[model samples]
Target: MNILIFGYGNPGRGDDALGPELVAAIQAENIPGIECQDDMQLQVEHVTDLTGRDAILFIDADASCVAPFHFSEISAEKDDSYTSHAMTPHALLHAFHTVYGKDAPPAFLMRIRGYQFELGEALSSDASENLEAASLFIRNLCKSPYAESWRSLHRG
Candidate 1:
């Protein structure tokens, strides 16, 4: 199945690098039928990247999420972020539907637990471990790119 793995975050900020870091790792695997993209943050323009994909997965670091990580399917919904420079995954999906006149491909989110988001700081040891766990889980997900397979593995 075709899939897009989109990760967004500021790499210079400590744990905020989780998203881009994970995207880089997955890109290195060179899996077929998977397209990977990373950016400092999500934006309305990102909706263009959602076209012609069977499924999409968004990854980011979340300070408030449970340790290690949290995963769940996300639906499209217009929100406050829609008017801002930085948009949420849901906002991006909403934009996709608005622009394309059709619902976006099934989407899921993985929020890797993070701490220490200070500028210029390296990833914390705990966050590094969490990244490892998330990486392993993503490798498995890539093995079965179907939405049904992903939903069954949801943690949220």
Candidate 2:
């Protein structure tokens, strides 16, 4: 399947760099049928990126998720972040639907567990371990990029 793996976070902040770090690793693999992107944050303009992909995986660092990571399928919905400059994955899906006049392709969010999101700090040792675990999980998921297969791996 044609897949887009979009990872977003502020690399300048500790642990928040997980998303971008993971994206960099995946990009280096040169996996076929997979396109990877990294950004400081998600924006409404990103709706364009959703077009023509069979599936999308949005990755971010989450302060509240369980250790290692959390994963789940997401649907279009207008939430409070819809009005902000930085949009959430759900808000981005909503925009995709509103702009394209159809439901977005199967989309999922993988929130890697993080701590110490302070500016100018490097990734914490604990968060680094979590990132390693999440990295393995994503690599396996990419091998079978089907919606149902992805859903079966969901954890929170």
Candidate 3:
């Protein structure tokens, strides 16, 4: 199965780099067909990669009032604004489906907190630790084969 992962963040910034850094940490595992990208934010062009993917996941850092390790499963219908948790997942999914035709791949957003995104060159020690945890999760996920849970099937 094709697994498409988009890790969003600003690498130049401090805690903002968490998304991309975590993705990079997902070392070689049995999962061979995984495709991962570190993007500033998703654009409509990304819809092209949604074709025939068993599953897709986006990881980003959010400024939420929660624990440092909180993660959530977001549907395509949710906001997924790539900026704030306030965005609705369903809305974004609908937008993609409208633009790309009603066959956008099944997607989920995993947002992490406890980040202080400063305009700096390095990541904070706390954010670095969280990135490691998130990376390990992705590594294991890619190893597993796709199930019906992640999708309703889309066009290629």
Candidate 4:
């Protein structure tokens, strides 16, 4: 049941902080079998961090996704962001498979919907509401045994 919850986003930005903020909230719960980590953005080095993990959950802010969040399983598809500073979850998974010589661990992406993303601005009221909803949803997941099984299911 080992699980890694990786959240990334810029906290200084208004709604862009949703990812890291959610990680903070989840860490405060101190739930067993769950390890939460956060960053301003994903990096190539993060690919190695997935080693020995049963499952990984990548969380980020999305301006066009459904309000609150959209959760879906992710696979190790080739991505062109290999040369970019910030890498996508798919890119990270691809790196993991290439470097480790094994299938990447089951992974899921939780794209939290956001409205504002101005630098140095506080979270917007609408973003706050969305954050609350996402927090509750993730909290319930932490308490449920089936939470980790989400990676096994495919939702087109």
Candidate 5:
């Protein structure tokens, strides 16, 4: 299955870099059937990139997530202002649905716990540990033939 992964966060900040760090690890492997992309944040145009993928994965650092990493399914939800600078996973899904007249691919969001996001800071040791754990989890998923099992198991 074709899997599209968008990992977005400010790498300049401390733990906020977890998203892009995970993407870097995944991309370094050069796995097939998986396309990994990174950005400072999600944008309107990114919805279009979701087209034709069997599934999509959105990765970000979440200060509030209790687990090392939490996975949740993404459902389309329209935003009042489409012109906003940044968009959430659900809002992006809504945009894709509106543009294509159909639900976007089965999408999941992986939020890795983050403690800090200070400017010009390197990752904290704790966040680095979490990043390692999250990276291994995602790498295993990418190695799988299909992401359907993960979707079914972690639907939210």
Candidate 6:
């Protein structure tokens, strides 16, 4: 797998549902070979998925961060204490790095802005809206270089 876009969140919570919801939206795009998962707790065993991938985009909801968006490659040596979510991508990266040494593929992190993580029946208005944006972003990342251009199709 060249790209693994992992999204994690609690579906019952308002804005926290962004991760799982984004997965569903991106699925309809039908980007071949792009693997998507909606997970609550990340495990070290999942690191095996990074073997031959060129890039990985990991996303989740942020509960305590000021900004709504950030795109960056996570550092191998960085501790995940600063992460806004309860689960940490850094830990996964670290485990992969340790197990595979330099062979592990590079991983990038993306996050959606969410103010409300409260238990609810549906997503909040703002969060529901951002789910569309987040899904579009994932689609752009998954489209292969040799595939037909579809990024232009997504507007706003």
* Best-performing candidate as measured by TM-score: 1
**Candidate scoring better on TM-score of 1 and 2:** 1
User: For candidate 1, which ten residues in a row score worst on lDDT?
Assistant: 147-156
lDDT of 5: 0.85
List, residue by residue over 71-148, the lDDT tens digit for candidate 3: 444456544563453333345556667776774666766665546777766877777776666666566566563635
Q: Report the lDDT tens digits of candidate 4 across residue range 39-148.
A: 99888899877987778888898999888778888888777887788889998999998898998778888888899999998889888898898888777667653535
Candidate 4 local lDDT, residue 4: 90
Ranking by TM-score: 1, 2, 5, 4, 6, 3
lDDT of 1 by residue, 9-32 (tens): 999999999999999999999999
Best-to-worst lDDT order = 1, 2, 5, 4, 6, 3
Please give, for residues 18-50, the per-residue lDDT of candidate 6 as tens digits. Answer: 777787777666677777776875666677876
RMSD of 3: 5.8
User: Which is the better candidate, 1 or 3, if ranked by lDDT?
Assistant: 1
Q: Candidate 4, after superposition: displacement of residue 112 in Å?
A: 0.6
Give the distance in Å from residue 90's predicted Cα in candidate 6 to where it truly belongs: 1.1
Residue 102 error for model 2, in Å?
0.2
lDDT per residue as tens, model 5, 32-136: 888899999889898779999999889999998866888877789887546788888889999998889999988889999899899999998888888888887
Q: Which ten residues in a row are the worst by lDDT in model 2?
A: 147-156
lDDT of 1 at 155: 88
* Tens digits of lDDT, candidate 2, 1-156: 799999999999999999999999999999999999999999998999999999999999999999989989999989989788799999999999999999999999999999999999999999999999989999999899888789888787
- TM-scores of the models, in the order given: 0.98, 0.98, 0.76, 0.92, 0.93, 0.77
Q: In each prediction, how many residue pairs overlap at the backbone (N, C-alpha, C within less than 3 A)? A: 0, 0, 8, 0, 0, 0
Better of 3 and 4 by lDDT: 4
Badly placed stretches (over 4 Å) of model 1 are none
Q: What clash pairs does model 3 have?
A: 77-89, 77-90, 78-88, 78-89, 78-90, 79-87, 79-88, 79-89
Off by over 4 Å in 6: 64-68, 78-87, 144-156
Candidate 5 clashing pairs, residues 3+ apart or interchain:
none
Model 3 worst lDDT run, 10 consecutive residues:
147-156
Q: What lDDT would each prediction earn against the true structure?
A: 0.95, 0.93, 0.63, 0.84, 0.85, 0.66
Model 2 TM-score (2 dp)? 0.98
